[model samples]
Target chain A: MNTKQTNEMQIEFDSKSENEGFARVAVAAFLTQLNPTVEEVADVKTAVSEAVTNSIIHGYEKKRGKIFIRCIMQEDEIVVSISDKGKGIADIKKAMEPLFTTKPELERSGMGFAFMEAFMDQVDVISEVGIGTTVTMKKKIENSSTFRVSGDELNG
Target chain B: TGEVKRFLRDDGMIKVSRSLKEIANKVRITKDSLNGTLNREPTLEEIAQELNMEREDIVMALEAVGEVESLQKTIYQ
Candidate 1:
C-alpha cells in the first residue's frame, strides 16, 4: 500500500473533439510505466475518452476553450484530472444520473459518468455554474502476481 | 419503379453510410502507413487530411463505431 507519487504529467490542449483521441492515448502512454494489462489500459482509455468528450461537448459546448489534463502515477495507481473553463454543470446529481443528458438532440447516450465510474476505481466531480468543471478519476492497477487468471472473470 | 424511387429518395442516407465505411477503411490504411512513417500514432487531423475528410467527421465516425461496440459489450456482459 505504498502510495508515494512516482511520476506525473500535465498537458493543455484546445477543447476540440479531434483531440479526444490524443488525450486518451497520451494518458495510456504515460501509464506504460505501470505495465498494466491490456484490459487495464483499455479501461483507462475508455474512461479518459468519456471524460474528455464531456469536457469538449458539454463543458465548452463545442466552443473554443482550453482543456487541461493532469496525471499522477503512484506506486500502484494512476489519478487523472481533466478540467475545462467553460459553462459548468448546475446540478451534478442530475448530471451524474445514468441516461440523463442535456443534449439529447446530439445523440449523447448520457452514460459518460457511468462509464467513468465503471472503469475507474473512483470518480469525483467539482463544478461551478459559469466557471468550469473538473473530473478526477483514479484506477488501481492489479499487480501481475495477483492478476486475474482469466479475463472472462470481468464479464462473469 | 417504386423500389427505384425509394432508393433515390434514400440516397442521402445510403451515401453517408457508404462514405463512412470508406472513411473507416481509409483510416485503417492511413494509420498503418503513418505509423510506419511517423513511428507513432497519428493524430486525427493527420488521418483526416489523408482521407480528405473533415476532422470532425473522422472523429464522429471513429467514436460512433467504438461507442456502439463498447456499449453493446457492456450491456451484454
Candidate 2:
C-alpha cells in the first residue's frame, strides 16, 4: 500500500540469526537515498539488528517463524517496525531493563531493548504472552543543508 | 530481509567483517569514553591510540554503536 505522507516497504523472512545482518543492511540500503551519515546509518542498523535478533532468538526461541519488517520514510525521518508471531514478552518493562534477561545461559547480554531505545529517537514495544511482539522505532535525520547553515551561523 | 550475497577473501578464506558495535565491544569501550574527552570530539588518531589499534583500522571501524550495555555483567546464575 502507498500513502501520501510516507514511503513504505515491508519484507518478511524466516526467523534466523543469519538473517539479522540482512534485515539491517536492507534497511540501511533503502535509507541510502537520504544520504545519512555513517554514524546515523550504523545507529539504525544496530537497532534493527537487536530487534530482529530478539524476535528470532527470544520470540521464536530458535524455532522456525516469520519476521516482518516494515520501513517508512517521511520527510526527514525513518520509521521501522519489526514484528514476529511467536512467544511474546510477558513483562515488557522488566524486559526493557538493562541487563535483565530471561536467558542468561545463552549469553544474551539482555541489552536489546536498551540498544533500540538509545539509537532511535523513539522506541515502542507492544507484546502479549502468546500473541506476538512488535518493536517500532523512529529516527529523525538532520538535513545537511540545515546543519551547514546552523554551523555557519554559529561560526559567523 | 533480502537476497544473500557472499564474497570470498583474498587469502582464499571466508572473512567476515565485524560490525562497529562488535568492534567496540572487543575493546571493552563505549562511545561515551571518546565523548567524555576534552574540548572537542577527539580524532581517529586519538581514538586509535586509546584503543591501541591502527589509525586506518580505527577509521574503518569508526561508527555509532550506541550504548548497548549500561551495567557490568554479573553472574546471575
Candidate 3:
C-alpha cells in the first residue's frame, strides 16, 4: 500500500551549470493542483529560479556541489526547501540583508531574500559556514472552493 | 509553481539604526538611476502609455530603481 498523505517530490541537481528554466517548469507542473493564476505561477517560478541560481552560483561558488529541492503540498499550503552541501554562509543575517550578494560580478541584485520574503507567507534560512545552507519557504493557498467567504462571491 | 522562491534584491534601510527619517530618505532617493535608463528596454512613449503616468513620472520612477522594476500594477491585474 502507498501512504501518500501529502504529495511530496525531491530533486537532486549539480550546483554547477544547472538549467534555470528546467527547474521552473518542473515546479510549475507539480503545482498543477493549485489552479493558480498566471501571475501567481510566474511569481513562484521566478522565485524558484532565483533560489536555485543562488545555490548554484553563490552557495557552490562555481565549484562542484549538490543541491536538494523538496516540495510538499498540504490542503492549503505548499512548502519548499532548497538545500546545498557546500561552503555555507558565514553570516546568515548579513547574507539576508537586501542587495548583499557575495558575487556582484554575476549581476546578482542581492534581492533574492527580499523577493522571497515579500511573496511567501514565511521564509527561513539555516546555514553553517563550513557545511551547508537550507532555505525553507511556505505559502498559503487562496482557494475559495474549499471554503466560501460570502454568499455574494462565487468560487469561479 | 510549487518550488518557487521570490527574489529580494534591494538593499533597503541601511540607516535603520540611525533614524526613521533616514530610512524614508533612502526609500525616496537611493535608487540606481542608471538601471532605469540602460536596463529598461522600453521607450518613453511606451512607458507613458502603459503606466498612465506622465513620461517624466515614469522616468523618475525608473531613475530611482536603475530600471523599471515593474511596469504598472494594472498590467498584472
- Model number with the top DockQ: 2
Clashes by residue pair, model 2 = none
Which DockQ-derived CAPRI band holds candidate 3? incorrect
Ranking by TM-score: 1, 2, 3
Residue-pair clashes per prediction, in order, are 0, 0, 15
Tens digits of lDDT, candidate 3, A55-99 = 888788878888888998776577888888878889989988988
TM-score of 3: 0.59
**Top candidate (TM-score):** 1
Evaluated on CA atoms against the true complex, candidate 2 attains a DockQ of: 0.06
| lDDT digits (tens) for residues B1-77 of candidate 1 | 98886787586433323466566667667878987898865654456557755444555455434532454466449
| Model 1 regions more than 4 Å off | A1-5, A144-156, B1-71
Q: What CAPRI-style quality would you assign to candidate 2? A: incorrect
Candidate 2 wrongly placed segments (more than 4 Å) = A1-5, A144-156, B1-77
- The i-RMS of candidate 2 is 9.8
Q: Give me the displacement of residue A50 in model 1, in angstroms.
A: 0.9
In model 1, what is the error at residue B61, expressed in angstroms? 19
lDDT of 1 by residue, A13-37 (tens): 9999999988986887677556454
Using lDDT as the measure, which candidate wins? 1
DockQ, computed on Cα atoms, for candidate 3: 0.02
